[model samples]
Target: MTLRRLISALLAVPACTMLAAMPVQAAELDPVRVQLDWLPTGDKAFFYAGVAEGIYRDAGLDVTLAPGRGSPDAVTQVAAGNADIGAAGINALMEAYAEGGAPVKAVMSIYSKPPEAVFTYEGSGVTDLASTLGKRMAYSMTSAPWPGVLRQAGLDPDEVNMVNVSPASLAPMLAQGQVEMNLNWVTKQPDAEALMEAAGRKLKVLPLSEHGLEGYAYSLMASQRMIDSRPEVLARFITATREAIEFSIAHPDQAAAGLAKVVPESDPAILEGQLRASFPLIDNEISQTEGLGVFEPQRLATAWRWVAESDGYAIDAIDPAALIDSRFLDTAAQ
Candidate 1:
């Protein structure tokens, strides 16, 4: 066929038919391994929702969500190149960075405010930090309020007799009077309440942040290599995650179903409640002003100082700017 004749013949065909005959370009999905700081929980339902709903895939990521031992484990895994990213406490990351140089940097702040709290039974007369003195308490060794928080509350960390306890038994221990109180996140107050009510007791939750121990909470940490070599991949992941969080915030029930599909063992209602609880933590004055996935440098710097200085590390040991890069968040927002 002559070139002019071929062009004429193509033009004569239906545009839809011609388009169908053209080769389609399939975009390759980038691999992204995320190490969750602990076993799957309702509070983390949005991650499962993101996967079940194809949020990550739509954003060009072949994301794998894996259960991790804890924040320290996740940080070490990401720093050792065993994982591309880590979902863990921002304070833990700062601690790791203070130890030396962590190979990861925070890309997004998952919790705008710290979620640490102390739980007690009703009429226990354990009202404040002063009441905790010489009292038996169960607390996750990993998550007790730091020295700075203790000082802010005007209590000595050494005054409290703290016993390490698993989250599963923390409530039961309190019910049985094995411990006067326990510590956990306020978001889990509902579950704790349910547990206490089942055991015929009332619950009192005292959030440490309300007493001046506030700091940035959970965050998304990416390996420095991934940030440097595949910035677009991280940006896409954040965009997808942010969208999933927004959807969960708006439709907790539907988002819970999405999570239930991924983890049927988890009660959908519990997951929904957990997701609902996270919404307040996710959206605060800072988030309202700066938008999601963005962090205030001054506040972040202050948090770093609080964590590092309190931990007896030199202020220069960990540079807050280096630990947080807003470029990906800016890109994802746009």
Candidate 2:
């Protein structure tokens, strides 16, 4: 062969070898099933983003985010080993810990600020804690946050005539004069407001934190068995979750889109608004300073105290440290 032909053949051979040397894609990821506190809402962006964008996959996990009926349900499912991890209101976990027999602990403080609240119609004359006395309340007696909110407001829940209602009926019942106040989360303010507006009224929000229920709002929970036997897996999962949460906070539109991709039944516009409304609870000043996933010990203590007090149990009898584990935040942060 001529010198040019010989050179071309040598280059072609190396190029073919280089093409053969590329790395193969990794195998199917380890599955991690997660249960959320409630249905597919914008506030659940972190988990949806993880599933839609493959953030969990990149971290060597395949996450399945399931919808929950309520916080108590989520906690029960995780404790019963029905889920690998769960997200729910810190209040729910507190009540479960107070009652005993649950085998789960909080791994991350998802919301630094408590979102527990009472919403009333603007013309209903229920403005704040002091004004709610003797008024009818549309509440879920079995929901975890109501007792704490009532005790913080210096009112015995027994004093009020409470009509147990489904969450969907709260705003409508309040507007129709069936109830004067409704127990809810401030994260869902937009939906509550819309519900009231459609009924020709405006909402008067009363956040439980302002009424003295100062504490971490919601948390990521894992079984004690997982922490004990699968420390590395738990740590990795927490870290990936934290990263996904921060990413969703910074890129809400993108996050909403990702969520919509996973939950096609959700309206993207509505989900984005829900996320924007939930910002105050998730991205508070304390969370910014301490880093995401960091829980305040005092907040945890206050929640535990309320659960014990409201349930006729002694606060001194339970160690708050046993209810939460912050060991994974370091890895989550990194």
Candidate 3:
């Protein structure tokens, strides 16, 4: 063969040999089932958005979210190993750990600032903690933060007549005057406002975080088994989640749209409003300084104090630091 023909044959031989080389291996994604503290509300939109955006998949995780009735339920599910990780109230996690020694620990802080609030109709005359005295207030077992809020506001917990009610009944009760106020998170503010507006009344939000209530609220938690056996998986999950949260905060409209694809029952407009309300709770000054998903020591202690006081446990009933493992967060940051 001529020199040019010989060179061409040599190149063709390598191309054929390369095609027969060992097949390239695709990285297997780790499956992570996440339990949510509540149903598919806008507050839980980030996870759905992350899944839609392929952020978790890019991080080598296949993530699924399971809806929950409440934070306690979410915590229990994670501890039982029914879920790989979960979003729940820090207070709920603390209570479980203190009482039954549930084998779960918070790994990433979600609502770095508590979103607890007392909502009322504009004309209800319940403007502040002092004005709420003797007024009918709707509550649920999940309203554990209010007692601490009342104490901080220098009011006895019994001063207000708290009527036990189902979580769904709160907004309707407040609007219909069956209850002057209802305790809930700000993340639900938009929906509650819509209910009030339909009843021809304006909504008035009394954020507990502003009225002497201070502490962490919702967080991402994992069971000890997962933490011990799948530390790398936890790290990848946290990193992807942090990115998801940041994306949600920056593009709530897009995030809401993405969530709508996952939960078609949700109204994207309403979801956008709720996601906007959640911004301050998630990306506050504290989270900005300490970085997202961090459990600041003093803040963790303060959060535990609120939970203990509400549950009538000794202040030191459980060591606050022990309830969290920041190794995953540290690894994610790296």
Best by TM-score: 3
Candidate 3 regions with alpha-carbon error over 4 angstroms: 1-27
Reference-based lDDT, residue 186, model 3: 92
lDDT of 1 at 296: 83
Better-scoring candidate (lDDT), 1 or 2: 1
User: What is the model-wide C-alpha lDDT for candidate 3?
Assistant: 0.88
lDDT of 1 by residue, 111-169 (tens): 88788788998788789878878888787765344556777766787887878877678
Off by over 4 Å in 1: 1-27
Summing lDDT over every window of 10 consecutive residues in candidate 1, give the lowest-scoring window: 141-150
Q: On residues 118-216, what C-alpha lDDT tens digit does candidate 3 reach at each position?
A: 998877889888898888889876557787788887788888888888888888998888988989889899999999999999999988888877778
Candidate 1, residue 94: Cα displacement in angstroms equals: 0.9
Error of 3 at 45 (Å): 0.7
> For every model shown, what is its TM-score relative to the native structure?
0.87, 0.85, 0.90
| C-alpha lDDT score of every prediction, in listed order | 0.81, 0.80, 0.88
- Judge candidate 3 at residue 203 and give its lDDT: 94
